[model samples]
Target chain A: MRKLLPYPILSLSLLVLWLLLQQSLAIGQILLGAVIAVLAARAFAALEPQQPRARKLGSIFKLAALVIVDVMRSNLAVASIVLRDRHRQQTAGFVVMPLTLRDRSGLAILACIITATPGSAWLEYDSVRGTVLIHVLDLVDEATWVDTIKNRYERLLLEIFQ
Target chain B: MSEVPVWVAALVGGLSILGAAFTLLGCIGLARFNSFYARVHAPTLGTSLGSIAILLASAIYFTVSAQRPAVHEVLILVFISITTPVTLMLLARAALYRDRAESSGDVPLQWGEDIVVERADAPSEG
Candidate 1:
């Protein structure tokens, strides 16, 4: 079964996405989508990358919800700043944070979380030292940002991926 | 689909224009940012706020016009939110590699001297 659908999940998802975008389930379209998916999956197989180990599925979903809410909140906050006429305040600055996430996937997830948040960006990371530099568009409180990143996202990611 | 109202169409058009403008702003920021350390902030603005505006417009318009919940567009937003930083980290690692190889000024690279980098063109590399 696995050999028959060598990239079972990928092929299924690609076909679904194709249908969603085209909003059609015609026989010809399904066949074309299937062919493209299979080809893509074959190309993917050449890489032979390590599969992501998701240890805790429930925690991952919860973390996803948390991230979404935070993203939306920050988006509104950022959009308001862009729309505002205040030229007096300069809201951008750089920050350095000490990190505990030594795992590659965990760190990757942290980087994504920081970058996904509107006010912050993942800059440079020193792997040996386990410290990451970031720039914030709206620098409010440095300690707060540090705490938020460390507690909110990093801990969950460590549990899920590490 | 019923006869589409002009106001809703205009709103969608406006939101789309805003989204595109934000995306352009992000690209400009990416270009203009001085250091790799500073440059990472630019694209996040585009991906977060810029894409949100576009996705919201999509969800709103589709739900209204098609008369159904158009929640699946959230997946794109999720994908971007999760992937952008990962790519940025990889790029930063690559940049750090090149910089350290050239022995550039103050790169904050603490990766140790186990890997030796020959200085062939010192003046140009830095």
Candidate 2:
């Protein structure tokens, strides 16, 4: 079993992806998908990527829910800023915030979250300084951004990843 | 497609229009924003909820019309959500590097200068 399915979760996801893409569930398609999934999983295992362990399933769900709500709220806020607040003075600037979550997967997820939201962009991460540079579209208070990232996302990410 | 219920049709229509409007606004923001970093954030409006809304509409339309689950659109959603950030991050980093090399005052100078000092001090702290 270990030899055939080195990465069980990866193989399962690949199989599901194949089935979804094919939009079929015939026995023949299932057999073919299984073959491809195993082969693909083996290939991926050869890459030796760092495996991320998600320790808290509940935290993961919580993070997803929080991200969705925040994204929706920011979508409206940014839309207003773009449409109605054009005349007002907007302070758009870069924010440098320190982060404690060091897991590569967590950092990657954080980058995705920051960039996916309408108002913020992940510019750079300084590994040596353990800090990230973010660009805010409507920068009101830098401390608020820092607090949001640290308290809301980073803490949950640490719980799940670390 | 023709036999879709009124509510389903309304929902799909509303979602499609919302998605298109958001995408259009994102493009407008892209063009209107003054700076590179600010402009980088514009398309995310389209990529995030815009794409999701459109994909959801497609899924619902197909599912209702065909009388079967047509959730393959979710693959597109997952792919877009994962890939957009990577491309945007790369673009932002490349822009930052170019701006720094040119000594453009638009971005913070500390990014370029502070890395060296931090790296030099790392051994002593350890």
DockQ scores of all models, one per candidate: 0.31, 0.68
Lowest summed lDDT across 10 adjacent residues in model 1 chain A is found at: A80-89
| Candidate 2 local lDDT, residue B100 | 91
Report per-prediction Cα RMSD to one decimal.
6.6, 3.4
Model 2: per-residue Cα lDDT over A1-162, one tens digit each:
898899999899999999999999999999999999999999998998888888989999999999999988888777777785555625789998999989999999999999988899999998987999999988888899899889999999999999
Q: What is the TM-score of each candidate against the true structure?
A: 0.69, 0.93
* Residue A112 C-alpha lDDT in model 2: 94
Restricted to chain B, the TM-score per model reads 0.76, 0.87
**Per-residue alpha-carbon lDDT of model 1 for A62-90, expressed as tens digits?**
89899888976876665555554546226
Considering only N, C-alpha and C atoms within 3 Å, which residue pairs clash in candidate 2? Answer: none
The residue pairs in collision within model 1 are none
lDDT of 2 by residue, B1-126 (tens): 369899999999999999989888889888887788888988989998899899999999999999999999999999998899899999999999899989885787655587788798799767
Best-fitting candidate, measured by lDDT? 2
Look at candidate 1 and tell me the lDDT of residue A22: 67
